[model samples]
Target: MAGIQFTDSAQTYLADLLSKQNTDGIGIRVFITQPGTPYAETCIAYCKPGEEKEDDQKLQLEQILVWLDGISVPFLDDALVDYATDRMGGQLTIKAPNAKVPMVNEDSPLNERINYLLQTEINPGLASHGGDVKLVDVVEGGIAILQFGGGCQGCGMVDVTLKEGIEKTMIARIPEITGVRDVTDHTVKENAYY
Candidate 1:
């Protein structure tokens, strides 16, 4: 999924709005319209036993339009929704991966250097923990989506290791890497050793 990148501030705003409107068991569903549509809409409806109430459906649609007034409608088109848990509490993050207007070179010399660092320096260092990192894909704006393997699949320290270790090392070696994201889905792994 390639799209605009949302700042932490924008994500916080959207998450707060969703939390306020979330009731019953329904959470917010943020999705973009099919390509070429001018507006992206957000809908809120609870996941009921079988079906959702008509009133609730209408309310959600109305609320989304109101919500869009505050946020940019076009920018929210291609977004990623994820629940984040921190010391404070759990919150949702609406991410726009394609936010940067000017496209940067994903295959730049800097990226090659970073890839080399991950393949040679970082991967070897993680061998002790049975962890491996793979560069899944690089976005045009210098964001690298990585996948974790081996023990890192379900390791509690994966986040810390990624931030304090992997990310830190990558940033130190190459300054152009704006962000490193883990695209691993831990629940579906069938070959995890630890």
Candidate 2:
């Protein structure tokens, strides 16, 4: 959560959401994934049914603000939580403006390559046990986000697969790929292969 900042718009959105709840208490829950998850999701909730009350709402907001003051705003700064309605259904979408986007390195031709080596090369080897590999993103610092799926979700061999297998193979084949990082949040999912 270092170097995180919240834009003024994000703060405003949060405040408005609190006001609309019409509950006695409200507070936002913020948590970061452990790494290697499909997507990063955040949730905000109003006071529990039995706990609703005017004082509760005030206290909740106060607590959240206090917590925000202590943390790096920019870490959570660019996040936007919006409510939308459509034919599919009404839902909340949490968008992170500063989320890392993959970049193509210009200096090295290898860097510029958008090859799905993992999909073609790595996945086949893992498919036997219903396992899969997902490429999350290529970060600015030459780090890549990877997610494990299927049998590999909570498999004890994840680290081994990541280090000796994935990392070694990727680095050997693509010299520009400096490092691989798993940004999976294991706690959110039950029975992970790793």
Best by lDDT: 1
Query: Candidates' lDDT values, in order?
Result: 0.56, 0.54
What RMSD, rounded to one decimal, does every model reach? 16.5, 13.0
List, residue by residue over 1-194, the lDDT tens digit for candidate 1. 22333445445655466567645433433333331221434333234323433322212332222222112334454655555678997765655533322122446576556656775578777778788888888788778889998877876677887888888787776777777889887775555545
| Local lDDT at 17 for model 1 | 65
Cα displacement (Å) at residue 109, model 2: 8.4
- What's the TM for model 1? 0.40
lDDT of 2 by residue, 52-126 (tens): 333221223322331332222333455555556579955556665333222223454443242345654677788
* C-alpha positional error of residue 185 in candidate 1 after TM-score superposition, expressed in Å: 1.0
Model 2 misplaced stretches (Cα beyond 4 Å): 1-115, 187-194
